[model samples]
Target: MIKLMKSTFYKEEETKKALANFILEAEMLSMGEECKKFEYGFAQKQGRAHALYVSSGSMANLVLIQALLNLGRLHRGDRVAVSSLTWATNIMPLIQLGLVPVVLDCEKETLNISSQTLQSVKATDIQALFITNALGFSGDMEQIRKWCSENEIIMLEDNCESLGSQVSGIKLGNFGLASTFSTFVGHHFSTVEGGMICTDDEELYDMLLMVRAHGWDRNLSAEKQRVIRDKNGIGDFFSRYTFYDLAFNARPTEIGGFLGNRQLQYWDEIVSTRENNFKRFQNCIESNDDFLSLDVRHMDVVSNFAMPAVCRTHESFEKYRKRFENAQVEIRPIIAGDMTKQPFYKKYVTNESLCENADFIHKNGFYFPNNPELTEEEIALLCDLLHK
Candidate 1:
C-alpha cells in the first residue's frame, strides 16, 4: 500500500553497525563525546561555526528562541513575524515565550512567505523574523536577509524541511542568525528523533549550549566558568541547584547523535537521488500543464525537492488525490496549510486576515512520494498514474 510519507532510512546495515558500535562502547545514552563530534561535523557541512544537537525540532526552536531572549536580542511580548503557512513548531516557541506572532501571507507561486507583505508590516518593536523554507523551497533569502539586516531584526530560519537546500550557493539555514533542523523519520535525514540548531554567532551558540541542559553552568568551558565565578562569586558555583538562566532539558541522546553521524555519511547520494526524482516529477507534471500547473518554478528555488508539486485548486486537488490513491499512489498536504487556521492560534494569535494564497494552497496543494528506495519503473508508473 502507498503511504503518505516514507522515512529516508537507507543504509540500514551501516546504521545498525554504527548503533551497535555506539552501544558496545556506552550503553547509557546522554549528550557526550559522540554528540560533540556529530555537532562539529554537522556545523562544518552547513558552513556554520556551531551546531547543537537537541531532543527534537520543536526543542531546537525553543532553545534557539530562549537563547536569543537570554542574550537580550529578543524580549517577551515583542512582535515576531512568520509565514502563515508553516509547521506549528515554527511558531509555538514565540507564543510559549509570550512573544506576539505576526502572521505574514504567502506568495501563491512559491508558497513561501510574501516578502512584499513582510516589508509592508509597520515595523514596531519587532524583535525577530522567523522564516521557514516551505516544503523544500528556499524562499527569497537575498531579499529577506537584506530586509532583516536593514531593519535590525534577528533572523531565524526554520529549515526543518529544507536541509540541503541552498539559495544562490548560500545554504538556507546559514542565512539566519540561527536556524533549526529536524532529522525526523521522513525528513532528508533520520536520527530516530533528533534536531539541531546551527549558527555562527558565538554568544548565541554559547547560550543554546547552556539552555539546552537545564541552564547549568557546567556546559560552559573553563574560561567561561572562571568569568561566571568572578562575576557571581565562587560561592554561587557551589550552589549547584541555582539556575543561571531560564532554560529547559532539550538534550538529545548519544544514540541519536551516532545515528545522525552515520546518516551524514550518505547525505550527498541521498540528496542527489531526491533531486533526480524531483526532476522526473517536475517533467511529468509540466508535461501535463494543459490540465494542471505545478507551483515550483525552478530548481534553485527548492533545495532537495522535499515536496514536489502545488496544484491549482481544491477541486482539482481532491480529484487528483482520489485518482492517485485509486492507482496506488500516495500524496499528502503541504505543511498543514496555513498555520493561522490551527485551533491553538485562535486563542494565542490575533490577526484575522485570511492569507488567500496560504489558504488556497492549504486546500489545493499536495505532495508526491519522494522515497529513494523506489525504482525507475515505479516512478514512471507513478508519474503515468498522476498524469492519467
Candidate 2:
C-alpha cells in the first residue's frame, strides 16, 4: 500500500559505499570526522557559520534549549512561547528543563505561529520563543524576527519540517538565533536518523557542540580551550574535567553523518522537485474549490512541499481521505496538528485558552503524495482522487 510519507532513498549504493568507508576509517561511530564533515556541509547549505550534528530533531531542540539556559538567558520555570500545533518535541525540551511552555495559536493561512495573537499575548518573563515551520511553509519570519528583536527574545526555529524552504532569499533555518533540522526518514533529506543545529554565533555554536557530547571538552580544539583557560587564568589540567556548563549526549552516529553528507549534495534538486509537485497538486485541486482549500498565500515564499495540501473542513477531509484510500493513495494529517489535544501536552503545557486555528487544522488538514519520484500520471491520479 502507498504510505502517507516515504523515505527518499536514491543512490542507495553510493550511500552504502560512504557508510562502508566511514566504518572502515572511523572505528568508533559517535561524532567522528564524518559527523564533522556533515556539519560543515550542512552549515554551508544553510549559509550559516556553524552546524552541529545531533542524534535527532528532538535532541537538537533539547541541546539548543539547554545551551540557551546555560547562557543564563532562560531559567528554570521561565516561560517559553511556542505554537500549539507543533510536534511534542518542540515543547517537550522546554518542559523537561522545568520551563513553562505557553502554547500560542497558529495562523490558519500559513499554519505557523499567528503574529497577531503573538503580539496580543501579554508578555511575562518569556525568555525565549520556539517556532516551527509547519510542513515546509516558511512562517512570517520577517515579522517574527522584528518582534523578537524588539522584545529582546531568543528565537529558535523548529525547522525540522522546512529544511529547504525560504522566505524571499533567506532560508528559514537562518532566520532564528538557533535553528534545528531533522534528516530523519521522509524529511526533505534523510540520514536514516539524524538532526542538525545551525547558527552564526560562535559562542552558541561552541556551547551546542559541548552539549551534544556530554558536556565534554574533548571536541574542542586545544588552542580554543587554552584561550578560555588563559582568559580565566585557570590551570590547564584542572580545567579539563571542570564541567563549566550543564550538557547532554546528543551526538550523531558517523554512519548517519555519512548518509547526510551524501544527501546534502542533492538538496537543490530535491527541493525543486518538491516545489514542482506542489504546483501540480495546486493546479489539480484549484477547480474543485467547492470542496478543497489551498493555504499557500504567495509564490515568493518557497515551500519544501513536503506534504503539499491542506483541506478546509473535517467532512471534506474524510471524503478525500476515503477516496484516496479507495484509490490506494496514501495521505496523513499535518504534523501533530493542535498539539494541545495531546495528553502529554495537556499534562506539560500551561495555557488559559486553546488555539482555535490549530484545533481546526488538527481535525481538518491532511497531506497527499508529493514524492519526487512519483510520475506525473501517478500524481494526477492521486489528485483526481483527492478532488473526486
Candidate 3:
C-alpha cells in the first residue's frame, strides 16, 4: 500500500541509530547547543536572519502572535486577514489572542491567495495578513508582497507546507516579514514533531526567543538578555526567574534538535525527490479532464508531502477518492478545507464573507501521497490512477 510517508526522516534507520547513541551519551536532553545549531543552519538555508525552534507548527503560530502583541506590533481587536484555505492553527491564534480575523479567499488555479484576492476585499481595517502557501504552491508572491506593502499590511507566511519551495527565485518562507515551518515526520524536514519561526526583524526575533519558554530571556543571546534584564532591572538574583511577557511553553527538546541536525544533511536530496514527484503528479493531473489544473509556473521548486487533486465536482472527488482508496493509496481532504466553515471559526468569529473558491475546494479537493520515498513503481501506479 502507498502511504503518505514511509519513514520519519529521509534515512529513518540511520537516524534512529544515531539518535539512540546520542541519547545514550548526552549529559543533557533539554534545549542546548544542538537546538541553537539547528536554528542557525535553518536560518542560513532559508535566507532569514533568525529562526527560533519550537515544539510544534501550531505553537510556532501562537508564539508569533504573542510576540507581536508583546512588542505592540498588534493589539486586541486588530483585524488580521487569514487565508480561508489554511489549516485551523493558522487562524486560531488570532481568535485565541483577541485579534479579529477576516477570511481571505484563495484563487482556484493557484490554491493560494493572490493580489487579486486582496483587491477584492472590501474590509479596510486589516492590519496584517496571515497567508498560507498551500501544498508547496504560491500565488504571485512578488505582487502579493507589493500589494501588502502598499496597503501597510504586515504579511506573515504560514509556510509550514512549502519549506523548500521557491517562487521568483526567493524561498516561500522569505516572502513575508516572518514565516513559520513544520518539521513533523512527513514535512519537508522531519524532527519527529517540531517547528520553526523565521524572521529578519531583530526586535521580533528577540521577542520570539523570550516567548518560546515561559517568556524568559534564558534562550536569548547574552546581549539581548542583558538589554532586557537591564530594562526590567532584573538583577542576577531574579534574571533567571523573570517572566517578561505573554508567552507559552513551546520549547523543543534536544532530541528534536539532534534529529533536525541529522535531517538537515539530506535537505537537498529530500527536496529534489519531492519536487520531481510533484512534476510527475502535475503532468498526470493536468491531462485528466476531471481534475483542476494547478498553476505553478511561477515556482522554481515544489517540495510538498502530498499532491492534491481538485476534481470538477463532489461526485468526481468521491470517484477519485474511492479509486485511490481501492488501490490502497492513502489520501486526505485538502488542508482543513475552507477554514471559515470550520466549527471553531464559526463559534468564535462573527463577521462572515463569501469564500466561493475555498468552499468549492472543500467539496472537491483531496490530496494523495507525494513523499520523497515514492518508488518508481509507486509513481507509475499513482500516475496510472490519475488517468481516467
Best by lDDT: 3
- Which residue runs of candidate 2 sit more than 4 Å off their true CA positions? 21-28, 230-240, 290-292, 298-301
lDDT of every model, 2 decimals:
0.79, 0.77, 0.91
How many clashing pairs per prediction, in order? 0, 0, 0
**lDDT tens string, model 3, 1-388?**
8999888888889889999999999999999989999999999888999999999999999999999999998999999988889999999999999999999889888999998888877546888989999989899999989988888889999999998999988999998999999999889889999999999999999899889989888877788888888998889788978999988999999999999998888888888999999999999999998999998888888888788889998898889989999999999888877777789988999887778999898789988999888899999999999998
True lDDT of residue 276, candidate 2: 79
Model 1 alpha-carbon miss at residue 315, Å: 2.8
How well is each residue in 19-105 modelled by candidate 1, as lDDT tens digits?
887799896688887788899899988889999999999899999989988988888988998888889988899999988888888
Residue range 83-146, candidate 2, lDDT tens digits: 8778889888987998988888888777787457688566555777888887877556888888
Residue 379, candidate 2: C-alpha displacement in angstroms: 1.4
lDDT: worst 10-residue window of model 3: 116-125
Candidate 2, pairs of clashing residues: none
